[model samples]
Target: MDLFWRYGFATLPVLVFVSFYRMGDVLTLTLSHPLWNARGYSLEAISMADGAVALFASMAGVAIGGWIAARWRMGWALVIGALASAIGNWVFAWLWDTPLADGSLYLAAGIDQFGHGLAGAVFVVYLSMLVNPRYPAAQYAFLSGFAFLLPRLVAGASGTIQKVIGYDGFFVMSGALSLAAVILLPVVLRARSRPSDQPEPAA
Candidate 1:
């Protein structure tokens, strides 16, 4: 109904953040093999670095992010995640050709995986807060669907974008995309924090 759509519309900023965030994620993930090959890395080395190390780092990040969000504000946690993701992407792209490039790549990949874990945890929290408690299941299902829906569509073009820009440029673009979430976070937080108006009790 219109109400459902309107409720979804109220969370437009979050949706925008999700779209940009996931698009960048998809781009990085989709092109990682090609990027590693270009960097003269063997498949086994790439698997060891990006697979095992990144996985463990991501688990740590998820735990740390969840702890921080529990201790501080979720909005601030999301900000931190965005900053980490952006910086990680920048590092990966910038250090791709310098000395110790393999080490640099591992470090950047770990940082990026951490950022992803953090952001993912915080995103679920955001959805929980946004959904109506009375209809938790239905509302969450609707909103959660909306969260990844547009992002999937936008991420479909990552191949074309990567082809046009190359790996370094693509990574930088991914980092740059996170800025939209940074700019919009404060607005979304403020809107979410506002209290609904209630009629005063009769004397």
Candidate 2:
């Protein structure tokens, strides 16, 4: 029940919201004229390339994250995902501006895609863990609602924030936020792992 509630109801919505917002932002950028110029690539070509990259990258991310989650606890998986996301964002924000070949962007895009994938997988696993088998339907519905709403609430401001900060600053901030998430993992895991009714299990 706890796992279901946490992951299914709580985490799913957040991940969905973030995914939607991220997709929208990427789409907007891919279609925008200025971004194309900034990248020294044609708008149509870049847009096409970006779309393709996002597709593959997200799929890959989800796969890897899911794999990791299956072997590890949700907290650990989330921690890893958060760290990867931070690193990817940092690279995108800082290193992306360097004069590199087109292949470089593709590689960077792949890394970002992997990060997102990992996040998605971790979220799914966590939510799954939260769902209680007894009241699966009700709990799932509750989680589903959050899955639908929170992203919009949190990610809605992303555009405005990005505008104010610019890509570099925004990436840095996002990375920092991700790191903060990572930092919380140990505390959360410790609490979760603490002995309950039964005496503490021998380590």
Candidate 3:
């Protein structure tokens, strides 16, 4: 269990990098496209607002998700998080083709941010529950390394992918990947239900 947890955490940077890269590329492409671009807004302004909103929303979601994880089942949280992530990605993708006024873009940005924020919060809580306090030093080191390295590696090709596949395709692919995380939830829940030397609470 510990090994599995460590490996997962260690790969997190890669996952995040891929996710963010896809997100940024899709956003840029969508907002800059002549037919899909938001009315009365510059690309830079849209990017800045979207980025800022995503950051704040993610922060808040993490705090809330952490609290929820303490009392809920980790498997359930993971499933919900996966679904939320997929939904968020879908919403962002939808924005690519949505024709709207300036204020409508703001609303769309808010919805996108909210979905991502909730997903982040639930995901953090799920991951945290997997850690064992006894081997904190080694585990933490692995997590830290992954946190810094994976994103850099995975995000590198994001721009190229966007150029090749376009915004809609990129977003659909990303959403599918995020949704795939849910497949592991049942396995995780079964593992948790087994009797252990030190039985821990769910989540």
Candidate 4:
């Protein structure tokens, strides 16, 4: 279990990637305020978009994300997923100004939900790969839990940040959080190309 955190930290960038992998997802936490209070989007609009539209859209995203990873590699899926989440936040920011009757709300909701679905599928697979078959449960818990650690902490301040900067600024800030993944991608990819710290081989 400690390997995920304790492995050769100096040489391996895995810890950094692991920590920042889903950082942009915190944006989802900030969404309710802008959509509900700031924008006055109705619960009916929320249901219409998050219910049927999200169901199909998220399903499609998961399928496509899986296909992309299969066709090229897992990294591509991760990169795309990170970008999707960031872009989704930006769309929501823009949607804040859109009139609800214009149906733009549905489009923004679909994009955000689809991104979550896509990111979630690949992220689970990636986390599983990082686990040891010997102690999969504990190791996976650490990695998965660690991935959200910083995001959850940062999310504590989300409301304050939004109030100070306004909805659009807050959304953009959330989208900008993707820079963590983007900036670290090269190092993470390089680390992947090399041998990863893994479970000891069976005798």
Best by TM-score: 4
**Tens digit of per-residue lDDT, candidate 1, span 59-119:** 9878987887788787788787777667666666765655645676677678878877877
**Candidate 4 Cα lDDT to native:** 0.71
Give candidates' CA RMSD values in order.
4.7, 7.5, 6.8, 3.0
Quote each prediction's TM-score: 0.81, 0.66, 0.64, 0.85
lDDT of 2 by residue, 1-203 (tens): 44433344444334443343233223223223343356676555556547897788888888888889989866667778777766666666643476745666666666766776776577666655545554567765665555535435555576677678776676666666555555444444443321123345487
- Give the Cα error of residue 7 in candidate 3, in Å: 10
Candidates in order have lDDT scores of: 0.69, 0.58, 0.53, 0.71
Q: C-alpha displacement of 35 in model 4, angstroms?
A: 2.4
lDDT of 3 by residue, 1-203 (tens): 55454445434443443244224323333333332342346776577656775567657656655665666676666555556555655665666766655555555555555556665666545445444666666765664455335334544666676678876676666666666656544444444322234556578
Runs of candidate 1 with Cα error greater than 4 angstroms are 1-9, 99-101, 192-203
Candidate 4 lDDT by residue in tens digits, 1-203: 34533444533466567666666666565554455545776778777877897899889888977777677677777888788878877887788766666378778778877887777777788778666566789888887888888788888888788789878787777877864576776666554322445657789
Off by over 4 Å in 2: 1-40, 144-151, 190-203
Order of candidate numbers by TM-score, starting with the best: 4, 1, 2, 3
Q: Which candidate has the highest lDDT of all?
A: 4
User: Total clashing residue pairs per candidate?
Assistant: 0, 19, 1, 0
Candidate 4 regions with alpha-carbon error over 4 angstroms: 1-6, 10-12, 192-203
Which pairs of residues clash in candidate 1, taking residues 3 or more apart in a chain or in different chains?
Answer: none
lDDT of 1 at 124: 71
Where is the poorest 10-residue window by lDDT in model 4? 3-12
